[model samples]
Target: SAVISQKPSRDICQRGTSLTIQCQVDSQVTMMFWYRQQPGQSLTLIATANQGSEATYESGFVIDKFPISRPNLTFSTLTVSNMSPEDSSIYLCSVTGTGEWEQYFGPGTRLTVT
Candidate 1:
């Protein structure tokens, strides 16, 4: 199993600003994903970050709004651009090993845009 941690466990930001959350994995991972969970909603996948390639954003999520970066196999970043109150959600970083089907998630970054 891989251990994952996210920076800025929680934060409060003003509307229209942006926040960048970082995810670090103790071991190299084959797959990394970014997800958002609203106040009363299920987890929604934002994008899949692959090493040395562009991130693939899910439906309703565009690169301009939720940009992702995978510098290598163990680190990635997700930036919420031009955030609004509606963007306030818990952002989680999930990962799976090279041959594993089980996915592990980080503690998550809680963002509250006011």
Candidate 2:
């Protein structure tokens, strides 16, 4: 089992600005991913941050818009670029530990784009 932590628990950003959210795991993990949750909505996968490789983004999401990086087994980051009102949501990160079937998620970075 592992614990997850995210930086800047919440923030308010202006349109056209960008925010980089950091995610860290207590133990090494093989799968790390980024997700977005709009108000009153369920989580939507943004990308899978593969270590030593480029992230695989989900449909409706572009690499240029939501860049992600997994530097190692326990650290990853997601950057929301050129923010807009529609981008206002809670960004969360999750990780699957070795031999684990369940994934644990971070507290989430609540972003409000104005």
Candidate 3:
């Protein structure tokens, strides 16, 4: 099993600004994922962060908008390149199948854009 942590539990950002959230794991993990859960919406996969390699983003997400970095097996970061009201959502970092395909999520970084 792996334990994950995310920085800035909540934040209010101005439109056009950006925020980078950090994710850390207690144990080495092969794949770390980033997800977004908007108000009253289901979770959506943003990208898969792999150590020493580029992150693989899912559809509708581009590296330019949601850039990710995984410096090692246990740490990763996701940067929201630009801010907008539409970007106001809960961003979470997750790890899959460390022991169980079920993924575990961070408390989440709630970003509000105004």
Candidate 4:
């Protein structure tokens, strides 16, 4: 089993700015994912952070916008660049297959871009 730790549980940023959230795991994990939860909406997969390699982003998300880095087994970071009002949402980091089909998620970094 692994535990997820996210920093700056919540924050409010200005438009045209950026915020980088960090994720730390208690144990070494192979699968680490970044997701976004829009206001009053479901979660959207952003990317898969590969250790020692660039993150693989999903459709509609690009590297320049959402840059991710997984330096080692138990650490990763995601940066949301050029923020906008529409970008106000909850950014979450999670690890899958911890138990059965269950995924362990961090408390999430709630970003409110003004």
Candidate 5:
């Protein structure tokens, strides 16, 4: 099992600004992913962060818009580039559980853009 922590539980930012959220895991995880949950919406996979490689983003997400960095096996960061009010959402860091397809999520960084 892995324990994950995310920075900035909540924040309010102006449009066109950027925010970088950090994710730290207690143990090395085989799979780490970033997700976004908008108001009244289901979670959506933003990207997968694999150590020593560029993050693989899902459809509708580009590296230019959501840059991810995994410096090591237990740590990663996601930066929201060129923010906007439309970007307001909860960014969650999740990791696949040991030997299971289930994922554990962090408390999440809730961002409100205005």
Candidate 6:
């Protein structure tokens, strides 16, 4: 199992601003993914990070709005660009190890756009 941690466990930001959240894993993993969870909603996958390659985004998510970086196997970052009130949600980082089907998730970063 990999241990995951996220920076800025919670934050309050003004509308029109952006926030970059970082996710760190103790061990190298096969795949890293970013997800968004709104109040009273299930997790929505934002993107999948592949080391040394451009992140692959899910439906309704664009690279311009949610750019992701996977510099290495154990680290990644997700930036919420031009954030608005609608962007206020909990962002999570999850990873699956080599040959493992289970995904381990980080504590998550809570963002509130005013």
lDDT of 1 by residue, 1-109 (tens): 7899999899999988999999999998868999999999999999989899999999999999998989999999999999999999999999986557778999999
lDDT of 6 by residue, 71-109 (tens): 888899999999999999999999996547888899999
Q: Could you tell me how far off, in angstroms, the CA of residue 98 lies in candidate 4 after the best superposition?
A: 4.0
Q: Any residue pairs clashing in model 4, and if so which?
A: none
Cα error, residue 19 of model 3, in Å, equals 0.2
Model 2 Cα shift for residue 47 (angstroms): 0.7
For candidate 2, lDDT tens digit of each residue in 5-100? 999999999999999999999987778989999999999999988789989989999989998989998999999999999999999999885656
* Alpha carbon lDDT of each predicted model: 0.94, 0.92, 0.91, 0.90, 0.93, 0.93
Worst 10 residues of 2 by lDDT: 95-104
Model 4 C-alpha lDDT versus the unseen true structure = 0.90
A best-first ranking of the candidates according to their lDDT comes to: 1, 6, 5, 2, 3, 4
What's each prediction's TM-score?
A: 0.96, 0.95, 0.95, 0.94, 0.97, 0.96
- What local lDDT score does residue 31 receive in model 2, on the 0 to 100 scale? 85
- Where in model 3 is the C-alpha error above 4 Å? none
- Which ten contiguous residues of candidate 4 have the minimum total lDDT? 95-104
Model 6: per-residue Cα lDDT at residue 93? 98
Model 6 earns a TM-score of 0.96
Local error of candidate 1 at 112, Å?
A: 0.1
The C-alpha local distance difference test score for the whole of candidate 2 amounts to: 0.92
**Residues 25-85, candidate 3, lDDT per residue (tens digit)?**
8888888999999999999999999898899999999999999999998889999977899
lDDT value for candidate 1?
0.94
